[model samples]
Target: MRARLGGLPTFVLLVGAAYCLFPVAWVVVAATKSTGELFSTTTLSVGTSLLANLGELGSYRDGVFWRWMANSALYAGLGALLSAALSGVTGYALAKYSFRGRALIFNGLLAGVLVPAVVLAIPQYLLLSKVGLTDTYLSVLVPGVISPYGIYLARVYAAASVPEDVVEAARTDGASELRILTSVALPMMVPGLVTVFLFQFVSIWNNFMLPYIMLGDDGKFPVTLGLYTMLKQGNTTPALYTLVVTGALVSVLPLIALFLTLQRYWRIDLLSGAVKA
Candidate 1:
């Protein structure tokens, strides 16, 4: 009975992995197919038109597909970087400082996390519209910079990884608070911050609603929105199905690469934290 119980968790994990990866697997196979094969061939079967499909996708609207790709990179990459920085600073301050209304502020941010993103997104659009910022890149980029969840993670990480004595020592040596945070605390919190950055990046990358609500121009559309547009249009123009599939496949590669590259930092940070503990 105990053995069976232990195996159950593994079974659940495998099931969950398959549930998530099944679509990805489908896209890989589907992207290779020609429009005819997309409908006619086996769902999982490989097709020969991968290169041809890519070429077609590139030619669409004078390589707007690549433009979408660049837009996604900019939104996710730059947004995540700024969000991580703000999270790190905010988190470190919350963890290290003692001041008035600190708990209240933290609690408010926690509540912000609980509020549904859709709820906030609507208000964000309305507010940005008031300032003549709607339909602009800043509309998307600015809101993503302040992640309550990222700040929360950074606080937890700073609390765990940054020692009070080290902070005091930096202060004793005449380092400014900003200097201490940047030079001492930030490096220690890299692992957790990287995780935060990855989360924000993926969230922003996969985010359809915010950009969908914010941007009016197709040229400024991220891959998620761009693919959504393609998928929507595919209902009328069937050939676009292949382009959409290929774009979906191509779009995930950068995220996969970023995750793989930064994953090592997570391991190293864990080991270092363990040793410190």
Candidate 2:
């Protein structure tokens, strides 16, 4: 009876999956088409021009596409790792210690989550400019490093995962607060930290607007912004559409590969560190 009842939900889910997969399927198919065939042929029909498209994209703007990819990886990889560690530290401190203005700080960070990225971006851009940091990597990265949502998640995980008794025990053992945090608390926050890392990684990788505003040089563009610029130029030169499509396909591959490779850590049972084998 349960299986039978699940059929409708499963059917609905499959429909949603198909809706999501359609565009990816279309991109894979469309990227293989020549400029003329892109619109001439049935939208999903595969063509023989995939190799040509890949080559064109590889050759575009003196191989600037690849440079954009590298910049994105650097930004996302370094930024996310740093954000995760910071989140872990902030979370641990908030969870373990109850002190003056604790509630105020926690509430402020929580309130930050409600603020849209766009709302603060311009102000951040202005402030970074004032500090002589604009149009550099730091301009884009600095604002992103302070992820309120990450801190919130980290706080929740730290509170639930690291027991106060264990913390007190560490303290009683004459463990310095920093030492206790580094060795004792951080190890326990592994699962949650991994979640934060992946979240920030995807967010940074997919970000368009911040990098768009901060970086003046095409050399500094992330894959999203780079691809968008390519697609925009494709308006005047139809042949470039193939390159843009191919670039999009290539860009998603790394994200897919990364997720597939380390996805075990993403099981993310924050409430319990134990993962099913």
Candidate 3:
């Protein structure tokens, strides 16, 4: 009975993996095909036109696809970095300090987390429009900077990972609050901060609606919106289908590389014997 139960869990995991990976597998195969082969051949068959498709994609609209890619990298990288910093500071303050209205603020953040981002898009747009910031890079980037979920995670992780004893010891050493945070608390918080960075990066990278509403210039569109525009165009120009598939495949490579690079940070146990003599 034990062996059967163990096998069942393994079997379920295998199925789940396949379910997630199958579309990725199809996209890989689809990207390699030429426009004609894409529809004429079987869904999973590999084709010989990958290089041709890549060349066309590069030359299309004077290489706007690459621009879209650069925009995505900028938005995700910068937005996540700023969000992580803000969340770390805010979360650490909430975790370590006893202050007025802290509970009220944290509770408000919890409520923010419960609210769907989609619901805020219109209101955010209206607010930015009043300031004449809409249709600019700041429009998309600013909204993502204050992530309620990221703040919440940072708070939980700071409470668990950073010890009060270490903080008090730093105070005894006459370290300024900023110095203590920079030198002591932030180091131990690296793993959790990394998680926050990765989460916000992925969220901003994959986000569509906010950008769709905020950005009017095609030049400022991220990869997600760029590919979406191509998909829309594909309805009339069928040949763009191959390019869309290829773009989808290429778009995922950076995310995979990022995860592989950051996975090592997750294993660091900075809290282990952190206060040892």
Clashes of each: 0, 0, 0
Residue range 1-277, candidate 3, lDDT tens digits: 9779989899999999999999989998898999999999998889999899989999999999999999999999999999999999998998889899998998998898777777888888898899999999989998889999888778877888899999999999999999989889988887889999999999999999999988989999999999999999999999999999999999999998998888875443334322231
Query: Scored by CA lDDT, what does every candidate get?
Result: 0.89, 0.84, 0.89
Worst 10 residues of 3 by lDDT: 268-277
Candidate order by decreasing TM-score: 3, 2, 1
The residue-by-residue lDDT of candidate 2 on 149-242, one tens digit each, is 7887788788778888998899999999999999999999998899899889989999888987777778888899998988898889888888
Clashing residue pairs, backbone N/CA/C < 3 A, model 2: none
Candidate 2: list runs displaced more than 4 Å: 264-277
The positional error of residue 106 in candidate 2, measured at the CA in angstroms, is: 1.1
Write down the TM-score for model 3: 0.92
Alpha-carbon TM-score of each model against the true structure:
0.89, 0.92, 0.92
For candidate 2, what is the total of clashing residue pairs? 0
Angstrom error at residue 37, model 3: 1.0
